[model samples]
Target chain A: MSYHTLQHLTVRLLFDEKFVKFVYEDPDSALLGLDLSKEEKAQLLAIDSRAWSYDSLRRLRTMRSLVEEFKASTTLVLAETRQLAFLDKFFSSPQFHDSIQKRGSMGLAFAEYLSEKFRQKELKTPQLADVLRLESLMARCRREFQKIRVTPLPKTLKDDLRIKFVPGADVGAFQANTVLTIQKIEKYLFEVNLMPAMVLCDDAPRLMDLPAVETKKKSYLMCVPAANGVSLIDIEKSDYLVLIEARSSLTIHQAIERAMASGITKSIAQEIIARALEEQTLHLV
Target chain B: MTKFFDKIAKIPRLGVGISGEFGSANKGIEACLLQENYPELVHFFEYGGDLDRGLDEHVRRWASTGLPTTYHFLDINIEERIDLTSDWLVETIEMAKEINATWLCGDAGRWHFGRRERGHQMLMPPILCMDSVLESVDNIRQIQEQSALCCLPENPPSVVYLGEMHILEYFAEIAERADCGILLDCAHLAIFQHSRNLAPLTGFDNFPFERVIEMHIAGGVLKETNGYQYIDDDHSPEPLESTWQILKYVIERAKNLRAIVYECEHNAAEECLDNFIKLNEMFPCKIETPKLTVK
Candidate 1:
C-alpha cells in the first residue's frame, strides 16, 4: 500500500479494537495485507490500544451524543443503562455498519436506525422509536431548511418543498391514540393537539423543554418539517395528505384543488393552508 | 498583504490566553478569563456548523473579550492529509477575519485516520517522514493562500514516530519551507520529548524557535499502555510542571514568540483560565496576552 494508506492503517490500529484483536490474536490476517516492515508492525503493535479501543472511528461518543440530544425521549425510554448499549448495538449492527458510511451527520444516521427499527418492529419501546424518528427528522429539517434563504415560498412548491422530507414516505403516520400513547410516555418529548381533521404538533415547546403534557389524542399526526426555526411540526390527517401531495409537482393551489376534489370545501382547505403556513408546516408554493 | 508575523511582531510582548471553543457561555468558563486576575487573548478550537448561522454571534462572543485570537484547526493534520479540501477553510477564515484573528493555526502532525465518507475502523499510522514535513509545508502554503489569512503550523503530540528525522528538526525545516510561523503546542512538545527518550529539554537549541508565532500551553495525562507512554490530550486542564518548564525554556530562547494558548479542550473553561494565574506565578510575566483555539 501507499504511505498514506499505511499511515491510515497505523492510526486505525490506534482506534479500532477489532483490528487490534485480529492483529494480536490471528497474527494471520496482517494489517490490510500491507507490505509492513518489521519495524512498522512493531510500532503498530506497541500502541496503548486500551485507551482508544472503545472509541471506534470516534462514533460511539458521537452517536451517543446525538441520541442524547435529539432523541431525549428515546434516551429516557432506553433509560441511562441502555443508552450506550443501544448506540453500541446500533454501531455494530447493519443499520449502523451499512449507513454509518455517511460521515457528515451522525444524528441523521442514528435517526435512520431508529426509524428503520420502528418500521421493522424491532424496537423494545416502540413508541420511543417514533419519538427518536421525529426528533431526528426535526434536526435534519432545521438544518436543511436553514440553507433555503428564502422568505416567500418558491414558485414551484411541489417540486422543491423548501423542506426535503415528505409525510408518509420519510415520516410515519399514526392514529391519534397511538401517537398519544407514545406522547404519554413522555408528553414533554412531543405535544399532541386536537385540530380539525388532524392533531397539530405545531407551536409546541422545543424538545429540550419536554414539559409535562396531557396525553390527549385527536385524529392523526404526520411529522412534517416546519420550513424554518429548525423546528419539526406534525400536521393532522387530511391536511397532512394535502401537504404531502403539495410537496411534489403540484402547486399550493393545485394541492388545495386535490383536497377540494376529495370532498373538502375551499374554505376548509384555505383554513388548513393558512394554519400550515402559520405553523411553518408548509412553505409558500 | 502584510504577513501576520509582521503585524504580531508589532505587539512586541509575550501573550497569554486559552482555547475559546467551549460550547456555551453558561459553562462557567468565560467568567474565568473575564475576571480581573488574568489578562487573556481568546483562541478558539472551533466554531461549530461552519460559518452557517451564528457566525455573527460567535464572532461577537470572541470579540467581546476584546482579546486577540489565533484561530487554529487542530483536526486536519497537515502532515497526513495532503489531500485536504479548502471549502471549510473558506468559511473558517472568513469568520476569523471577522473576529480579527491574529493568525490561523493548525498542526504539523496528522490527527484523523481517514476520510469521513468512508466508515473506516482504523486510524492512519502516524506519518513521521521528511515527505510529511514537505506535505505540511505545502498544506500551509495552500491554506494561507486560500484563506487570505496568515497561517501558522503547530507541532502535534504523537504516540508513534514514523520517520528517521527528528520531530524538532522536522518542525524547523517545514516552517522555513512554508514561509509561515509556528504555533508551538508545548504539551505536544513534552510528549515528543518523552517519546524520543531525550532528557527533559536536553537538546532544545536545535529546533526553530524564531518561527513560532504562537505557543499552545496545556497538559495531558501521560498514559502508559502496553509498555508505551502516550500523552492522552484529554485530562488535566493545567499545563504539567514539566510542560511549564518547556514553555519557560521556549520563552527564554525564542525571538519571535507572540502568544501563549492554554488548550484545555476537555477541561472546564474556568480551570483553563486559572492556568494563566499559575502560569504567571511560575514564569513571572513571561506570558501576557496573545492569540488562538483548536478544533
Candidate 2:
C-alpha cells in the first residue's frame, strides 16, 4: 500500500449539510432509511459487536444506561452507530493514516457528542425525546475513541532486540502476574490522571515499538512472570496511553534472548510503563 | 575600557545577534538599523507546525538564502516538551550545534522536572529556566558553569510592565556579576509601555548598561482580547513607534552593544523585515549599512 495514501476521510466529507440533517432527523435508523438485506444487517451487527469488543464490554453497559436515562431518540443513536461504522471502516481499511491521526479524529467525535449532551442538559426547552437523542449520540461517540494508527519509530531505534526484552528465567513464569501488574498500574494511572504515559504492546513488534515499558537494566524479584515483555516509555514523543498483546509467548522469549533480557529490568520498565499508561488511560476514560 | 569598545566596535563586522524574547529582540535590532548601525542581521527562526524541514535543514535553508546569521528560538511544540530526555531535545540541540548557533534560546517544555540528566552533555547552552525572571537567572548561572554559551531569560523586562522592572534589575545585576553579556530583546520593553499603570523606565536609566552585548528587533501586532487590545511580538507587523524610541535610547546608553539581530517568525506577517528597513530609514543611527533591498 502507498505510505501517503489518504485514508480516514472521516473529516473530509463530514461537513456535508444534507447528510448531517439526515443524521439529526433519524439516528437509530440506517442512513437513507433504506431496507437492509438480511445478510447486510447481519454484517452491520457483526461490525458493531467487533467495535464493542475492541475497547471493552464496560462501554456497552455505559451506553445502555445512557439510553435508559435519556430515553434517547432513535435518530441520535443511529447517527452515533453510523459514526462508529465510519471509524471502524477507516481503521480496518488498508488506508490507515498514522495511528495517531485516527486516534485524534475518534477523540474529536466523542468530545463533540459529549459536548452536545452537556449542552442538552442545560436546556430547559428541549423535549424529553431530543434530550434522549443527545445522550444516545454522546454515548455512541464515546465508544469509538481509541481507534488509532500504530506507526513505528525510526528503525535505527527500534531494530535492537536489546530494546525489546525483559530479563529473568521465571519471566514467563509470572505471565498472569505480569498481566495483573499491568492492570494495577493502569488502574493507578487512571485514578491519579486520565492520560497514561505508557502503553504496553505484546503484539507483533513489527507493528509497534512499545515506548512505555523499559527493561534495559537487570534486577532480582521474588517471583518472575512466565511470559511478558516490556519497554520504557518517553511520554513527550507519544501522547496516548498504550496496550499491546504480543502475538505469542515464544516471540516474547526470542526478544528477551536477543536482548539478554533480565527479569528485573523488565519488571522495572513494566512498573513505569504501567503507571504512565494508567495515568493516560484514566485521563481518556 | 578598550576591551569594551573593541568588542562593541567589531560587532558590525561579525554576525549580528539573534535574540527571540518576544518584543525586545525585534525592537532593539530595529533601533540599531534605523541609526545606520548595520550589524550583520541575525534572524531568529521560530518553527511553526506542518513545516517539513528539521532544525538543521531550516538553518541551512536560511543560510543558503544569504542571511548572515541564523539562530533558532526553539519555541512552539519543542518548548512544550521540556523533558530534555526526549529525542526531540537531543535532535534540536544537535541541530543547533551543527548549525553553529551563537545562541540556542528556549523555555521549559511542559511537564519538565527541571533536572539535568546525564548523557545529555553534548547539547549546547544547558539553560533550563523559562518564564520567571528569578528562576531564569538561577538556571543561567547553572548553565554558565557547564558551557561558555550565554543563557538568556526568554523575555526581558518590558518598559511597560513595571512589576517586571525589579526582576529585570535583579537579572541585569546577575548578568553583570556573572560576566555574561545580555541578549537585550527590544520588543518586551515596548510591551512595558502598552501597560499604563506600571512606572515608566525614566528614573531607572542607569540599570545594567555594561551587561548588554546583543540586541533584537522584530515586527508584531496590536490585538484586542478580554476587552483590551495590546501589542504582542507573537505576530509580526511594522515596529512599534515606542519600541523604536526605547531601542534608540539603549544604543546611546549602552557601551557594550555588540551584535543586533532582526528576528522575525518565518513568513510571520507580510511586511516584517520591510518594517525593519523603514524604521532604519527613519532614525539613522551609527552602525553602517544600506537599506535591505527586497527584490
Candidate 3:
C-alpha cells in the first residue's frame, strides 16, 4: 500500500500540473495527508519540477502516441486552429486521468471528451465530431475483434445459411459524409508521409488544404474488422436496420422478413444481405 | 544458484534487437541481413513486443526463418502486483511459444503508473526501496513459473530516479530474492550513473555479476534543459563512453553472460556496422564468417 501510494504520487506529479505546482510551492502541506516515510518524502521532494513541466519529454512522448493513434483527427484539428487548445483542457480534466486509471482506451476517451465539447458548443468544428466518433467506433471494433476469434466463411454461402452480424461490427449515422472526410484526411496524411522533411520545416506549407465537409445530408456507416485493418462501409438506412436486426441469430429468410416488416421491400432486403455477406460484415453461422 | 544455466546457455552470444514496429519502418533488420559480414556479427534476433499491440508481419517473418529469438515484453510492470493478470500471463506465454523464444526478459520497471493505458504508458523506474524490491521478486517468480521461461529483469532507463537504494542494489536484491537471472542494460545503467553523478562502474563491484545472463548496449544522447542535465536513451548508432565502460566492466565480471544485443533498430545499416563490428570484436560469435572472393 505504501508502494501504491508512492506510485500514485509519482503519476500525479508527472501528469497533474496543478498538483505539481502545489507540491512545488508547499511541499509540507501537500505531504501532510500522505503516509510516506521521511526518505520517500525526501525522494519525492527531490524531483525537479522543471523536468516534468509542460512540454517535458514524458508529455511529448504521450503526445506522440496520441497523434499517431488519431493522426487524421489531429492533423485536421492542427490545420484548422494551428494549436491543440482542446487537448490542454482534456489533459487537465478528471476524465483523462480517470480513463488512465480505469484502463480504458484513450482514443475512445478523447473522442467522448471531444463529443462533450461539441455538445456544449465549446468546439467550433462540427465535422470533427463526426470524424472522432467514426474513429472511436473503428478503434473499439478493432479491439473487440482481437478478443474473439473470427470463424472463417466457407468458399460459398449456402442458400439457407444462417447469418449474423460480425462479433464486433457497429453502425452509426453522422451529419457529414465521414467516410469521404476520412478519405481526404488519409490523402493529407499520405502527402505528409511522403514529404517528411517538409513537415519538419515550419515555413513549408503546413498541410494540404482540406476543404470543409458539407453537412447538408447525413451519412450511415458500418465499421467492422477486416483482414489487414478496420474497414468502413457506407450503408443505407435500410441496410442499417437489417444489420441491427441481424445482431440476433437469423436465417436469410428471417432477416428479409424482418426488414420487410420495417417497410423495406423484399428485393432490397435480399440485396443488402447479399452485399453484407460479400463484405464479410455479416458472417454465416 | 544455477537454476537457469541451461536456459542461459541456449541463448546466442551476438544478437540484434527490434522492439514494437521498430524494423518495419527502416528495415533495420533487413539492412543488417544484407551485409556480407552479417553472419559473423549477428547470431540471434531479440524480439521486443507488447502483447496488447501483437506482432507485425516483418517480425514474424524473421522469427519464422528458424533463427533463435528471445521475447522482451514492453507492457508489464513487474513491481506492480495488480499488473500481473492471468490473461496477460497466458498471452505472454502464447506469444513466446509462437516465436519459439529461448527465454523471456523485460525491464522490471513501472511501465505505466495506474494502469496500462496509452497515455499512462512510460518506462519509469521503480522507487528503489526494499518494498519495491520484494514486490518485483514476487512478480518475477510468478512470470517465470507461469510462462515456464527464464525471465530476466532488465534495468529501465529514466532521467529522474527516486529512493534510497542505488539502481544496482535494487536489481541485485531482486535477482537474489527471485533466484532469477538479470539482463544488464549498459545504456540504462550509464544513464542512472549520469543522473546521480556517479561513475559508470560505481556499483559494479557489489552486483551479482554471476547472475547476469544477457547484456544490452544502445546509443544515448547527453541532453540539458532548464539547467537539468541527463542522458537520453535514444538508441542511436553512436553509443556513449560511459555505456562502453559499463559493458567492459560487466564483460569482465559476468562469466555467465550468454547474449549481448545491440539495440540499434532505428539506425541505418552503415551507421550501425561499426558498433556491430565493435560488439563482434568484444564478444565474438562462434559462427565463422565466409570470405568474399572476386569474380
Leading candidate by TM-score = 3
Each prediction's DockQ? 0.13, 0.02, 0.30
Residue pairs in clash, model 3: none
Model 3 C-alpha lDDT per residue in residues B1-295, reported as the tens digit of each score: 2666656666555444434343443555462353335666676777787866777666677676666678899899998888998878998889888988878898998887665655667778888989999889999999888887889999999877888889999999999888899999999999999888898889866789988988999999988777777788999888899999999888888887878888887777678878888887787657544467999
Clashes of 3: 0
Q: Which is superior by TM-score, 1 or 3?
A: 3
C-alpha DockQ for predicted model 2: 0.02
- Model 1: per-residue Cα lDDT over B1-295, one tens digit each: 2364565566544455556453444452553345334443332323222323434354366666664555655456576443466645666677677766766876656544343221332223236666677777788888888876667776776666565556677777877777787777778778777776775586556676777767777777776765555666653776676788888888887777766666554556566655766655543444444456676
| Number of the top-ranking candidate, with lDDT as the measure | 3
Question: Could you give the interface RMSD of each candidate, to one decimal?
Answer: 6.2, 25.3, 3.3
- Candidate 1 per-residue lDDT, tens place, A161-252, comes to 33322332223454344445445444543343223223233554433323233345434444444432443345556676555565554555
User: Residue B60 in candidate 1 has what lDDT?
Assistant: 64
The TM-score of predicted model 3 comes to 0.74
Off by over 4 Å in 3: A1-19, A27-41, A53-61, A64-82, A86-89, A149-167, A176-219, A234-285, B6-21, B24-41, B51-67, B81-100, B110-121, B204-206, B265-295
Better of 1 and 2 by DockQ: 1
